[model samples]
Target: MEIFRNKKTFTDYIERQKEMGKRIGFAPTMGALHQGHLSLYEAAQKENDLVISSIFVNPTQFNNPDDLEKYPHDTNRDLKLLENTGIVNAVYLPEVADLYPAGLKSKAYNFDGLENEMEGKSRPGHFDGVGTVVEELLRQVKPDNAYFGEKDFQQLAIIEKLVQQLKLPVKIHGVEIYREDNGLAMSSRNERLNAVQRDAGKVIHETLVKVNDWFRIITIAEINKRVKDIFDDQRGMTLEYFEIADEQTLKQTDFFYKDKNYRAFIVVNVGEVRLIDNMHLD
Candidate 1:
């Protein structure tokens, strides 16, 4: 597969592809790829003639500098995996300056009500950064469809909203969240955890499931409190937020077990790693 590290080269490559009249499928990621990320490529490959994958660790989307610094990176390993896929047509490995140049302007797109809850509440200005970068990528790549992992359910929601609100000519499709055998959601940050912390990481999703199960009869407030209690009971886990909300609108609800179409989400800190996960009731 062709690798483009600069705009001129990447844009030229895309122009050539356009001349061939091939449909493009794009997947944007911040490196340290796992099975979850590969699943996105598989979806793209099945539906499009060409697959474009980007690996840039976005600095703007990161709320904590330390967290951003600690986020995993292994271009060599990632390339090996993508090469095995045999479906990736090109890989865009843009530099930080290329994505957001020195003294460059940054733009933010408001995701209406979806940008200020759960992960947004915990990481202020996070979605704005996400919107800025994603908008730029979509405009540049102009793919027929883009694949996003449902592990970041809220981020996917915001991107879908951005496309609709701005009328960007691209479809945003979400792949189901992938997890390890122990049930911890797969993430690049998982590499940061030591063996014991890795085991403790499972508690985050398990707690999400436990809290979601509680929604069957308890009030949202009670369920939220109970979710927090699990983290309180567990040592070294910091609860950021545990929320139950309407899946599409992301507005917090009193309770949702009866509706059977709501979503349960949680964001918490395990040592230095910040993790988030969500489950659909239906």
Candidate 2:
């Protein structure tokens, strides 16, 4: 697959593809590719004539500098994987200056009420960085469709809001969250976990599964307590937040209504890496 590091070159190529009447699909990612990322690429390939994937470790999105520093990267391996997929037309690997030549003067984004809970509350200014980088990428690529994983469910909601607010032409698609056989949600951050911590991380998903089962008969408060109790009992796992909320608005609700869709979202620190996962309750 062709790799373009220059923004102008990539956009110019996209323009040429436009002239050929080819529909484009885009998937933006930080390196460290995995099966979850490839699933997005595969989904894009099924619907679009051309598919483009980007790998830039966006500094603007990290609230903690150390987390940014600890984030994984391996360009050679990533490129090889993309090539193996044989569906990716090109990969955009832009330098920091390429995307933000004037430095990060982030614009404020109003995601309605979606940005004020869970991830928003824990990591201040995190979504702003997400909004800024994602906005810039979408502006640069301007693809007909973009793919994002449901693993970062709130971030996906915010991006959808951003597209609506900006009225961008691109269709934002949320692919289902990919997981390991044991149910640990796949993430680039998973690389940091030691063997023991990797096994312990399974508890995060296990708790979500248990919570989904209890939703039919239990009160919301009881559900919350049960989730907490599971993490409390597990060593090396710290529950950040767990809530059952409307799948669309992501606003935590007191009780699950029979007709509305609901999902359970959870975040935990296994070792020093933070992992987030969500499960839909029909």
Cα-based lDDT for every prediction: 0.84, 0.89
Task: Give one digit per residue, the lDDT tens place, for model 2 in 1-282.
Answer: 889999899889988999999999999998899999999999999999999999998887788899888888799999999999899999999887777778865667789979888888867778888888888899888899999999999999999999999999999999999998789999998988899898878888888888878887889999998888888998887888888889888899997777889999998988778889999985
Q: Give me the runs in candidate 2 sitting further than 4 Å from their true place.
A: none
Q: Per-residue lDDT tens digits of candidate 1, residues 186-277?
A: 98878888888889888887877776677666677888778877889888779877778888788878855454468888887888777878
TM-score attained by model 1 = 0.92
Worst 10 residues of 1 by lDDT: 99-108
TM-score of each: 0.92, 0.97
* Clash tally, candidates in order: 0, 0
Scored by TM-score, the top model is 2
Question: What overall lDDT, based on C-alpha atoms, would model 1 receive against the true structure?
Answer: 0.84
